[model samples]
Target: MAGHKIPHFQNDAGHSAIEIGVKEFMCVGANPPFDHPHEFLDMGAETEKVCPYCSTLYKFNPALAETETVPAGCTLTTEAA
Candidate 1:
């Protein structure tokens, strides 16, 4: 059996909802063609924050173990703009 790898960054599809670690990352406005600029957001402080551009909801799930990666319903599909 093999262990799944966790990527440093991913797209908005699987990123719509997430539970992140202490690392700092950015959020882009749109999905692809209509995407906007990237804005860095910190998850260490709040439980959730909405993207000003795309209006997607982002959440922090503290229940997940550090060894775990992306949340359920997420695919690690795309990257930032």
Candidate 2:
């Protein structure tokens, strides 16, 4: 054989790993008590947005800061590192 190519396979040998890091994320939304006269004129005004997963009410002030992480055996920890 001129050259042997090694075939790659996925295994669980290195599945368990841990990663620790910090990130800053900002969430913004349309101003509540909206500044626009047209919006205020509307009787049914929905001013706030919510997070689908956490159901956090989106706001304009102080934004939102959070520490997010994945478990030791999570695939994200392995791929994102």
Candidate 3:
């Protein structure tokens, strides 16, 4: 994730689980200000993982793009400094 754009996602809808396209990404808990610490998560050989801070389960979906997330609009488009 160091020289690349590791997709950042948020659980704005407060969904219990989210289906994501990539196996590696970041969970921001929610939007800025109120958002928790940005955490990097990897599923490795698994299909799902839960964010340690937010406890939001992320399921892998091969059909979706790296920037895509189920329920839509969950992908944080702007980069955090």
TM-scores for all candidates?
0.47, 0.19, 0.88
Ranking by TM-score: 3, 1, 2
Alpha-carbon RMSD to native, per candidate: 7.4, 21.1, 2.2
Candidate 1 lDDT: 0.49
Off by over 4 Å in 1: 1-23, 63-81
State the lDDT of candidate 3 residue by residue for 46-81, as single tens digits: 999999998999999999998888888899863532
Which of the predicted structures, 1 or 3, would earn the higher lDDT when compared with the native? 3
Candidate 3 lDDT (Cα, whole model)?
Answer: 0.87
Structure candidate 2, residue pairs in collision: none
Sorted on lDDT, best first, the list reads 3, 1, 2
Give one digit per residue, the lDDT tens place, for model 2 in 28-69: 111333112111111123434333323333222223212222
Better lDDT candidate (1, 2)? 1
What are the lDDT scores of the predictions, listed in order? 0.49, 0.23, 0.87
TM-score of 1: 0.47
State in Å the error of residue 40, model 2: 26
Which model, 1 or 2, shows the larger TM-score? 1
